[model samples]
Target: MTADTTGVNATTKGADAIDEAIAKGIDFDGTPIPTAKLELYTKVMALEANRQRSGVSNTMRSRIVRIGAKHIPQAELDQLLTDAGFAPLKEKEIAFFYGGK
Candidate 1:
């Protein structure tokens, strides 16, 4: 039997990879992304794009806190924010993001 050379088991992981997959109309798992889901995502993103402006830094901080908390320890994340010239976490953020830990 010939070796399987389709690269079926090879996968790239990360946000860029996911985005590329989405742009190609495929899911990371190699399945087609349903048109309904794509349509809903596009609609919601359109709404977000037109939403009233908050400061760019505020938006950046929100995303960092939201996504960084999942991957970095609380103290490390706080230090990272400070080093990156962003505000360190506030007590409320600490309570919200690291409360369960």
Candidate 2:
């Protein structure tokens, strides 16, 4: 008599071997992870900075700048304007005459 050794058993056996390996100490490949988080953050930050520079929401900019003036320091305000390409002005000029100080 000949035995019909179906491949389903072999498939289950292979799976069992894999499961046993995992139950012990075998490491399986996992989901992909970022290799350089700093680089990823830097790239995203640069894109966001460029988007902000393009006057993405100029009216929103005005509102925020308007409110922030009441809270931020004069030096910090001046630097923010400088980064946005506006020339810095004297203290009184910044507070009274300029669009953003």
RMSD of each: 4.7, 21.6
TM-score of each: 0.71, 0.27
lDDT of each structure?
A: 0.82, 0.52
**Model 1 misplacement above 4 A:** 1-11
Name the TM-score of candidate 1.
0.71
Report the lDDT of model 2 for residue 91: 61
The reply for model 2, stretches above 4 Å from the true place, is: 1-57, 84-93, 97-101
Q: lDDT of candidate 1?
A: 0.82
Q: After aligning candidate 2 to the native by TM-score, how far in Å is the CA of 100 from where it should be?
A: 16
Clashes of 1: 0
lDDT of 1 by residue, 14-58 (tens): 667665665666765667778999889888988998999789999
